[model samples]
Target: MSPSGKPPRAVDIVRRGLLTRPWRSAVEAVRPPWSPQESQFTQACTRCGRCVEACPGGILQRGDGGYPAADFRHGGCTFCYACAGACPEGLFLPRDGRAWDIVATVTAGCLALQAVECRRCQESCADGAIIFRPVAGGLWQPQLNRSACSGCGGCVAGCPVSAIKMEHSHGRSLAGM
Candidate 1:
């Protein structure tokens, strides 16, 4: 109820609920590139800062429990194998294997969906994963190519509306490759 004793509108109530709830579905702990399954990686990792220092992308940081984690806000991963090479423990898999199965996903807060023209996400995507398709009498709609996306998080930080996120692929386990 408002200070004036009026009930809040249904839209306002729904909006508040949505805003309060965690919006980042990919809130799971993000490990460094080429990391083994979470359980094994945690057990094998020695909490050393070598990998963090070796990462040229500046995305790797000390995460919870003093383990290395990737924070893509600074930049996208280049898959340079620096972190893996620097790690003293055998916590990472072979560099030839897929780095990770996570992929970029766009949420409803996109400006284009709200009738605003914006293409920052698509432009920042280096892999050409994000494509815009024109809509008749309306703004173009962005579509994500999950297959093409390297899950490097290139488009996340550049999004003007903060609509991009990295989510685990469907039918894939977050732990295993």
Candidate 2:
């Protein structure tokens, strides 16, 4: 509702500062394995850097606000639970629960989508989450099986074009290309 007594439209929400802007400057950071929801994690975490030092894969780093986040540029998560064990606070869930709801997403920049043959992403995916399907007149297209993806980020750093990204699985759809 507005002071003018007119019903608010979707655009009004954005224009009137009731909703956040849609654009993002960077992708959301991935937290360490077994981390609680972002707000809870931030509230509970002490930025002690124990989880980052304990990471055998060396993927954990001090991200924004000095909180630890996963940087999959070097390797994928092994789900070793070392980060969870090293946390001095209750910022993480039990290791028996799923780590997080993240999954790998392939963007339009994939080589195969441009008709250039490439299978690096598929090869790097140990969980066999990435598959290639043949087209009548085009090269095989990469298809991500969201259910099979372990969200390890194995394919992210290995991609030649940097097309892969980790996205929350809530409303994300499987690869259509």
Q: Global lDDT of each model?
A: 0.81, 0.82
CA error at residue 58 for candidate 2, angstroms: 1.2
Where model 1 places Cα greater than 4 Å from the true spot, the runs are: 1-26, 171-177
Put down candidate 1 lDDT per residue, 18-54, tens digits, no spaces: 8755643325667887888788888989998899999
Best by lDDT: 2
**Candidate 1 lDDT:** 0.81
Candidate 2 on 113-170: residue-level lDDT in tens? Answer: 9999999999999999999999889669999999999888889878988888888898
Tell me the spans in candidate 2 whose CA falls farther than 4 Å from its real position. 1-27, 172-177
